[model samples]
Target chain A: MGLNIKPLADRVLVEPAAAETTTASGIIIPDTAKEKPQKGTVVAIGTGKKDEPLTVQVGDTVLYGKYSGSELKLEGNDYLIMRESDILAII
Target chain B: MGLNIKPLADRVLVEPAAAETTTASGIIIPDTAKEKPQKGTVVAIGTGKKDEPLTVQVGDTVLYGKYSGSELKLEGNDYLIMRESDILAII
Candidate 1:
């Protein structure tokens, strides 16, 4: 069994591997692309924290980096996004 | 003038571009390395937020991904890491 963690604090619940494989310009990305985008879906989100309170919520589709958040497997599915700090942008 | 932001919440202050260029084997890293490591120093830290309290402080060395964290240029030198979530591991 994997972690059934409810991310604490400003952490977010994201289903990793949700990003589009192609660029916005409709260019099918090749494996050699220098900058790769990560795709994920927001499953759950933590309550707002200190000054920089939480802005996004569950079900929001987001994009992150390949090496951003710690890896986790839940119910046989891979997911991540425990902290809001790791998020580069909301999009 | 650039942003001298005091990161709010669980965000940590990290001096980007601080990771070692070589691996544990001391092999010189080639540019073609798939998992490229980004190096930086922790310059400042933010107060902890929510349940996941802040675990790091200023001046601590850290390592992150090249595509992680928002980019910033302070005083003619490039720097980043406004959020602790972006940090992959504390080295």
Candidate 2:
């Protein structure tokens, strides 16, 4: 769980939950029909901006908007870089 | 500026900056060429979450991403409802 890239200013780096590969009845899900994951584990955090410290922390599981955050690949791992407010709920 | 719609959890209501109607040389811009405005004034804000309180307040001039927030028409005026974190900076 280490990366050279670090988020800055209220941004967060999240490791998205794995997309569903199979359905409840064991039907294989196709890539085209798969939806972007909405949940993830916080891997890294930015220094909350001046006068606005973020409430989320490393290792916190969070829910985010379907289109929230920019996608990035760091060290062969996919990550989402989004503002702290993009997070919907802490689960 | 009042609206009946209230944003939920960490959301904020924004009144977008006026689109450019004329260029420096006084050319009339057409509606199709208008890009979504990136700056706005906060009209309303949510109470934030249990532990995470929002830093942006009503009347705060703020910057946001091009596609951030959902557009809504209230009382014949347009507004955007976005999570507080969508705000990039307060001016």
Candidate 3:
């Protein structure tokens, strides 16, 4: 958790929720049809802009646009760099 | 514009900025290589969640993720339905 990634200026580092591989009816989801999870846990946060103080916290789970944020790697772990506004709801 | 569409629950309707058809040097850019504009004017907004009253108002020019919102055609004009958080900065 001590990776060097530090979100800056309304950006956030999110650990995306695990993708679902099976449906409620137990039908396995095909790899090509699987979509990236829209939910994630905030691992790091930025100070935010002067006028807009960020509302999301480091431990909060959030919902976001399905394809929002840029993907990157830090310390061998995958993460997404998202603008604070990309997060839809705090869960 | 009196479009019949109304955004619901933290969603905002945005009219994207005009795409740059040419670069600074005036090199004509072709349609095939164009990218969607990241800035837009907020035409409409949702009521927002109980705790998160919306901040951006109609006519506010805002920045958002390039692919963050869903596109829909309303009244012969194109608009994107975006979650409030998908907006990054008010310009």
Compare the candidates by TM-score and give the number of the best one.
3
Instruction: Return the TM-score for each candidate structure.
Output: 0.42, 0.45, 0.46
Give the Cα lDDT of each candidate: 0.58, 0.71, 0.70
Tens digit of per-residue lDDT, candidate 2, span B63-89: 566689999988888999998767655
lDDT of 1 by residue, B1-91 (tens): 2234345455554555534567564534358758755666776565666577776667676666666654433344445545677776666
In model 2, which runs have C-alpha deviations exceeding 4 angstroms? A1-91, B21-37
Rank by TM-score (best first):
3, 2, 1
lDDT of 3 by residue, B1-91 (tens): 5544345558888987677766454534344555533777898887676589899999998878766776544444556778888898896
lDDT of 2 by residue, A32-89 (tens): 6545337788988877877898999999988787777765444555667788989988
The residue-by-residue lDDT of candidate 1 on A1-91, one tens digit each, is 3345667787887887434445342323234334433556778777757665675567665544456776777777877866765554343
True contacts kept of each: 0.00, 0.00, 0.00
Model 2: how far is B3 from its true place, Å?
A: 2.0
Clashing pairs in 3: A85-B85
Candidate 1 DockQ category?
Answer: incorrect
